[model samples]
Target: MSQRIVDHPVLGSLAARNQLRFTFNGTPYSAYEGETIAAALLASGVRTLRVHEEKGTPRGIYCNIGHCYECRVNVDGVPTVRACMTLVQDGMQVTAGTVLPTPLKKGGHSQ
Candidate 1:
C-alpha cells in the first residue's frame, strides 16, 4: 500500500513536507513532521500495533485520541506509549507490543 495521502476530498493535494525516518520492528518507514505514529503506521498498511498483554489478542488504533490505550507501543526504550497520541520523530525506534513484558500471567499472576 502507498504510504502517502495523494489527495483528500476536503484538503486537496497534500504537499510534500520534510520527511523523517523511523523504524517499526526494525523495518524503516518515512513520515512527515506532524504525522502521528498511528497515522504513519496506518498509511504504511500496518494495522496491528500491539497485542493483548495476557490474551495475545491483536490490537491497533481504536481511538485516535489518547483515551484508548489500544495503540500502545514501545518508543525508544519507553513502554506503553500511545501511538495515536505520540508524534513521529526522526530516527525514532518503535517496537510492537508483543515484545513488551506481560503485566500478568494466565492465572492473573504478576510476572
Candidate 2:
C-alpha cells in the first residue's frame, strides 16, 4: 500500500503519474515520476535513509527541503547526495550511507 496523499484539502485529487522502478539499498522499489527520492522512500515506509557518520544514529528526512543534510544517501557512484533534493530516476541505484569508523575505532590509525 502506498502512503501518498491522494486527496488533499487544498490540492484536491492527485494526478496520475508514470511509475518508475528504482533500487534502494539493492531493494527494488517503485516510485512516481517527478517525485523526489526522499518522498518515494517515505511513501514506502522507509524512514532511516542513512546512519550518522560517527555516532551511528539513524537519519531520515528532517527538513524535507535542501537545507538539512540529514537525508544524505549514496546515489549510483556518487556519495553524499541529498535524497530530498534528488528526483527519483528509472533504475537508479540508491544506498544508505554508513557511519565511517574513526581512527580510535579502527585500531588507533594505521601506522
Candidate 3:
C-alpha cells in the first residue's frame, strides 16, 4: 500500500528531499523534512493512528486540519498531541494509542 503521490497530473513526480528518521509504535520510518506527522504516517501506509480510549475503535486522520482530534498521538512521551499539525522532526519517537505518560498532579506527583 503505497501512500506517496508518485506522479500528479499537474505537478509531475514529487522530488525527494532531506529524509528525517522517526519511530512509530517502536518501528522506525523515514519522512521528508517539513512533512507533518500525519502526512508521514500516511506516506508509510499507517492508516490507523490510534484507538478510542473508551470504546477501543480505530481512529485515523479524519480532518487534515487541527479541528478534529482523531490524529492524536503520544509524541516523545507527550500525550494527546495532534499529529496533523505537528511537523516530523528527526529522531522523533511517536507512539500510537493511549500509551501516554501519566499526567502530573498539582503537587508534581504522577496522577
Candidate 4:
C-alpha cells in the first residue's frame, strides 16, 4: 500500500486478506473483498480517478463516501459506476478511466 488506509472510520471494519491479485491498467495490485474500489485505488496511490464529460476536467474522490459521482469509472466496460461505493473483487480488472486517450464520441459511434 502506498498512500495507504489499512482501516477506515466510517466504512466499517475489514477482514484479513488471504491475498488475491487484480490489475488496474495492466498493473497488478491487491485488495480485500469488502474494501471499496476507491479506497483500494487511493490506498495504492491512485489520485485521479476519471475525467468528466467536459474535456480536461479532472475528477477523483471528491466525496469519500460515494455521494458524488466524481469517482465514476467503467468496470468491465460498464460506465458511470461509483467506485467509492463498489467493492473490489479478486482478479478484477480495474482500469482507471481518469483520463481518456481520445475525446468523447459525439452522437455515439456507428458500427
Candidate 5:
C-alpha cells in the first residue's frame, strides 16, 4: 500500500512518500515514518482504538489532531500514548492499547 498521504479528507494529499515498518500487537503493519500514530492507524483501517476507560465502550478516531486522546494506543512499549501525537518510526515495535495496554511484563521486564 502507498504510505504517502495521497488522499485524505482532513489533511488532503501528503507532500511525499514516507515508507516505514512497524508492529502492532505482535502483528506487522505499514505506514510512513513521522506520520501520527492515529493517522497511520486510520490509514490502515484500524478503527476502534480500545474500550472505554470506565464502561469499556468502543472508540475510534475523531480528530486527526492530538487535541483528543481518543486514538491513544500503546506505542514503542509505552501505554496510553496519543497515537495522533506520536510519529511512526523505522523498525518501531508498536502495541495496540485500545483496552488494557499495560505492557506484558516478562520476568518484570516489558517485552
Candidate 6:
C-alpha cells in the first residue's frame, strides 16, 4: 500500500509532481517534489528515523512541526537536521544518527 495521500475530499486531488531521488542510510528512495525528507521516508515505510543520541532508543517523527527533534537526521555530512522540516533534495544523502560511543578513561574503561 502506498503511504501517499492520492486524493483528499477537502483538498482535491494531489497534483502530480516530479520525482526526486535521495538516499537514507545508503539506501535509495524516491520522493515527489515539495515533500519533506521525513514525509518521503515515511512514504517509503521507514518509521524509525534515528535512535536516541544517548539512550539508543528508536525515534521517529513526533510533533512534525520542527518543535520536536525526533526526526533529526544527518544530511550531506550535516548532523541533526530535522527531516520533518527539511524538504527532500535530489541527490541528497541522509543518514540516521546513532548513539555516541562512550568515552574511554585513562584506564581503558568507558567513562
**Index of the highest-lDDT prediction:** 2
- 6-110: candidate 1 lDDT, tens digit per residue: 767875564656778999999999887788999999999999999887678899999899997999999999999999999999999999888435545465454
Ranking of candidates on TM-score, top first? 2, 6, 1, 3, 4, 5
Per residue, candidate 5 scores C-alpha lDDT tens digits across 1-111 of 533457779865565566777777677777775576667767777777766764578877878677877876776777888777888887877765544443343454444
| Global lDDT of each candidate | 0.87, 0.91, 0.86, 0.73, 0.70, 0.89
Candidate 1 worst ten-residue window by lDDT = 102-111
TM-score of 1: 0.83
lDDT of 4 at 65: 84
Clashes (N, CA, C under 3 Å) per candidate: 0, 0, 0, 1, 4, 0
lDDT of 2 by residue, 1-111 (tens): 689887679755546677899999999988888789999999999999999998898999999998989999999979999999999999999999998978867675898
lDDT of 2 at 89: 96
lDDT of 4 at 110: 50
TM per candidate comes to 0.83, 0.85, 0.78, 0.71, 0.68, 0.84
- Candidate 4, residues 19-75, lDDT tens digits: the string is 556777677877776777888888888887776665767688987787878888877
What does the lDDT read for residue 48 in candidate 5?
A: 75
- RMSD of every candidate to native, in Å, equals 2.8, 2.3, 5.1, 4.5, 7.3, 3.1
lDDT of 5 at 91: 80
What lDDT does model 5 reach? Answer: 0.70
Order of candidates by lDDT, top first?
2, 6, 1, 3, 4, 5
What overall lDDT, based on C-alpha atoms, would model 4 receive against the true structure? 0.73
